[model samples]
Target: MSNSSTGEIRIFDVNPALDRAALAEQFSRNRRIQIRDVLTDESARNLHGILARETPWGLAWHAAEDGPHNIRREDLATLSQDERVAIARKLDTAMRGTDYGFTYAQYPMLDAYLKKWSPGSPQDAVLELINDQPFLDLIREVSGIAELVKADAQATLYGPGHFLAQHDDSHVAEGWRLAYVLNLCNTDWRPEWGGYLNFYREDGDIEQGFRPRFNALNLFAVPQRHAVSYVPPFAPPERLAITGWFRDR
Candidate 1:
């Protein structure tokens, strides 16, 4: 199978490349690359729609009073989509800065975290995707990492007032080689709305940042300090994405 999108559930198609030299150079020198339209438009739309309604979210509570307070849902089940989103947004707003605060394990920010899905899990279309060979091939082609054997995927929902503090995805036990976020927001989303993916230098200065570009895949080598900035109250209710890592195992 070519790993292209099916009519029933559209998967993403890699962007057509006339010249891959730039992509290879970016990944090689910077250890990161952000590709637009990683998913087909229809596929992105369908996936976002499914996430908006189908995900069964639960509140993610961190250890400290100023710790993580976003809602998460790991168990997929049948439910009303609109109703769930409403509930998620309501809770997200209620917890912001009042009793709940942003205090990172080592950094600072507020954001929701979703339960991750492993391969072969039921009703998990996201995992069904990372397992596709074409997608793996695409990763290899761009990242220049030939030995990458597996991938992990999870759904992340960032509602208004939610954010992720700066942290490096580096635990020897986890074995994550590269981190990626498949953004599922509207294309017209504005920078002033917040929820940007910010990259930092070792000195703690921001080297660069990325808006939640719809249908885009932002991939970076593991252990880089980065964060998702807070989504302000005026922004849309939900910021959705499928985030995870490509592993060497």
Candidate 2:
């Protein structure tokens, strides 16, 4: 897609052109929808590469008992190989399922990464493109959420052994109306390799599961129970995506 650069920020012109009425109806009916080919081919491929290689990532671990904790990159670098493995084992055991606990890794926040990585990084431009008014307007049209005015975004990398447990993205204080994921993996990404996004019913049964599909945007109404499955050790590729939420101002 063609885009214009203003100062250091690039304004992307790509639009998935989803069926707004159908998408709104689906969200009203089921509270979630997944739309494929969310971006032009070249733009998606370029973003996939930039996010995979350029962003600075941080590890986050969570336990049912302890909540969430972050392992800074410097701290991780100081750990010995065995120490790191031991930590991984602990996280793995804790995050096996809802009955246990969960942990995961994420790249820097789009806003924070922009400020820290350098002036005018491409990652910042991508973030700007997605957060621009046109994109937010599209989300509003599709989801039928007139109140959604702002968005928060971050890149995520799920490598072997990372996972997230089931939890509703409900923080009334945060005004998060809908959660979104822009999957950047190739369509060839395998379901068996794990890293699937799953939504659960009240009884804890899986209502839906989505494999990572390139150029796809998945959106779900807030306060719905969902989780990301663990990335298996044998998975051939890392699961990468940009995820966040649209919020009421």
Candidate 3:
């Protein structure tokens, strides 16, 4: 968790002692795996703090044909209460239909960093770390995708009423080789709280589901059927994580 000479925030300290071979074998079994304690204890806590306290979250809603629209925090502040509720109603309708849709809070780390949205913020440093050699090397060794050259990231927080409908990560032209979620949730995350990452069989039965475990990294090959379960109203306030795709391009 050390910073640079100029004191730039460098909170990412991935666990250097992970068993890559075992993780690789696990991933090879089903083309997906969740590695626990992916980061050092101090690093994980520091990242959790950044997401919970420092980052300004925004709304990401994808219910229409054109979306996955991002409403920044400033823009969100401009919407009336009724307008917000209307948007929620649209999401509810979309969710009930047989189509792709998702609603959650997010901070697009790569876009923010590239556009200088929050200069010198920890979120920017996190994006840099994910694309850096150490982290990418770790992912490469475990997923056995030696061509994975870069990654894009976004900080996500799934609270009450949030969900993502089932869809295969099939944007092959985008160079997506694998999708990853670095869960930074509270250690006490309960299964009943919802927000599990669910995988499905061709017949639509759930093949597997992974809880939002703190300090765990869930990696799965792209073009697979998956979805994020809805967070019920009584669930905890935050199910936080850093999520994105590891691309070979």
Candidate 4:
């Protein structure tokens, strides 16, 4: 529900008792992932505003089954007058620590995006604060298939020309029992753009795609192959989404 009054934002508060149980059951039985269009339109829109004013890099857009706001260091020059000013004033300070965000040299996650350009960045601190809610907490408690290691885990942000190859969440070097993507792109995402998230099952077949819709939460198991695909050449806005992994106790 997009309410134009709150500047095109709507907050869909989960009915704690019911929604949590539903989420737990869905994830336990599906064996893949569940896409929930839980947030209202207005809330999604307002999120776009806060995100635009906060991220370190300029926004680039892409669409696929799943997408993240890709903010590049160089794209800063292309920003509109207002956009540039917003970046300068609002993000200048916040961008400092978020520099390294997170890093892994083995896979060359987005080697093409920063190979020659960014020499060194914040090594590992790409993470965020999870919304304090019962539904999310309950899901963790019952999904006995996983152990909660980090509350707000942030792996890395996907910028233009950058992408993470496919691999199972639980199969990553560190091991992931479960996976969750908390979308923070905070923008209007169209389906055709191409940065959709690709998931795979144990059978080595591609699973479903999670469209980069704002405020949508994509939850699934993480023992098989899964990869994040980059958007096409022309897509303008970047993507912003957070990833979380559960460990086995």
Candidate 5:
């Protein structure tokens, strides 16, 4: 597996049809499964590479989130060890406290983190790496509520003991819609590590979790119940992929 971030190209240039086909196969295998894993060794590693280098930032989060939040800490099996370490360092810097703000602006629909760590920073470069072929393909394929024309993405570099509480991504905009992601972190993740995407069933009784697997896309509707599982203070760093949604104006 190779790093998914090394290449540069137009966001819309990559062929999404192939990606859409691949997802259809996965869906056929597991219909209606709340959480699924999609990234291969190479794809996962590639995700880790991009995420590691993203700029860090202080997002806005309210004590009381209006809707639901779903987090899937993706892994990067396709990247080199050295590259993975580099991304971890950035996450360490962004996530300093046990629970820090995760949204650039306060809204039930959107929140973000980046290696650069500031608003209105350099985004085109990051977007170039983020909108990889498969990742973009999956976002385009996952069908349902319309609004999010494209996924709203940014790396959530959770540093030592850093965590994002529960929240929602509904009505981020008229385009704020579906949620999907291509995880780009290393594969050596653990349970005690505390960075799991906690999903609450509509019933609000049975809450389950989806581990952030590499290359996997978590596509779900907005206004759903969820949260970013805890990331215990890892020494160097811990990270994963974050992306989602297709919108219609």
Candidate 6:
């Protein structure tokens, strides 16, 4: 779909060459697979520009019993230097221990659409594209889950020091059927930079891990053990993506 006022910018066009049967076979064997170059070149570049330059980022984190905080960009800017440091320290402490914790930047796409935030922006266009018939059919074919009727999205950025602790997505009551990450990182992203999507074995070993690759779509059945690996201080500033779950309801 073209979102530009001049009608020249196409924002969410999926690649026409994807092999659905092959992807479905892979998913059937392992319940997860990453499709590279999932979007057309023009579309991917346009979407990346939207994430890197147009979106308003916010802080989303949880440290012990303190919070499952969703602080907007404006609110985040109001914090004192010491307050920012304290929040970082608390996140570090919680993550180091045997407890649930995460710290990352996000722009809730669905929420923004419903709230009329940034109307006509590329973010809203992308969300609408996700729920449109073509994209939904693609997801259904790859997952072999015909019941997936809708999706929710959040634009996420995992800059230096960000991480997500491991947890199984067992929210069955919420109708979550599959989890997807539409990676939008730079093509030059390196392994040492971290920010990998890792799946764990029962013995705590990493069963599999997928690096953040530009324009790649990673899909996995929900209720699985997984986490986003920490991005170290030395890593680059942007590990951007659109992430969320596909639901039956």
TM-scores for all predictions: 0.74, 0.86, 0.95, 0.55, 0.56, 0.95
In order, the Cα lDDT scores of the candidates are 0.66, 0.75, 0.89, 0.48, 0.46, 0.90
Across residues 55-147, which tens digit of lDDT does each residue of candidate 5 receive? 333332222222123222232335478854644454444455443233221111234233333343334344543444444445545442322
Residue 219 miss distance in model 2 (angstroms)? 0.4
Question: What is the Cα-based TM-score of model 4?
Answer: 0.55
Best by lDDT: 6
Q: Model 6: what TM-score?
A: 0.95
TM-score of 3: 0.95
> After TM-score superposition, what is the CA distance of residue 32 in candidate 4 from its true location, in Å?
3.1
Ranking of candidates on lDDT, top first: 6, 3, 2, 1, 4, 5
Q: Give the range of the ten consecutive residues with the poorest summed lDDT in model 1.
A: 103-112
| Residue 241 in model 3: lDDT | 97
Residue 133 shift from truth in candidate 1, angstroms:
0.7
Clashes in predicted model 5: 42
Q: Compare candidates 3 and 4 on lDDT and give the better one.
A: 3
Against the true structure, what is every candidate's RMSD?
7.2, 3.0, 1.9, 12.3, 10.6, 1.8
Separate clash counts for every candidate: 4, 0, 0, 36, 42, 0
| Candidate 2 lDDT, 1-249, residue by residue in tens | 224343533334555565777767877888888877767676677777777777667777766565466665666678799976776676656656445466556755654654675556766666666667777887888888889877778788888877887788888688899999999886488778888999998988999998888878899988899999978888855588889988897
Output the lDDT of residue 79, model 2: 76
RMSD of 6: 1.8
TM-score of model 1 vs. true structure:
0.74
C-alpha-based local distance difference test score of model 6: 0.90
Poorly placed runs, candidate 4 (over 4 Å): 1-18, 38-47, 58-128, 131-136, 141-149, 155-160, 171-175, 185-191, 201-205
Q: List candidate 5 stretches off by more than 4 Å.
A: 1-44, 54-137, 144-148, 234-236
lDDT of 1 by residue, 149-198 (tens): 87776567676656666778886477788898888876477888788889
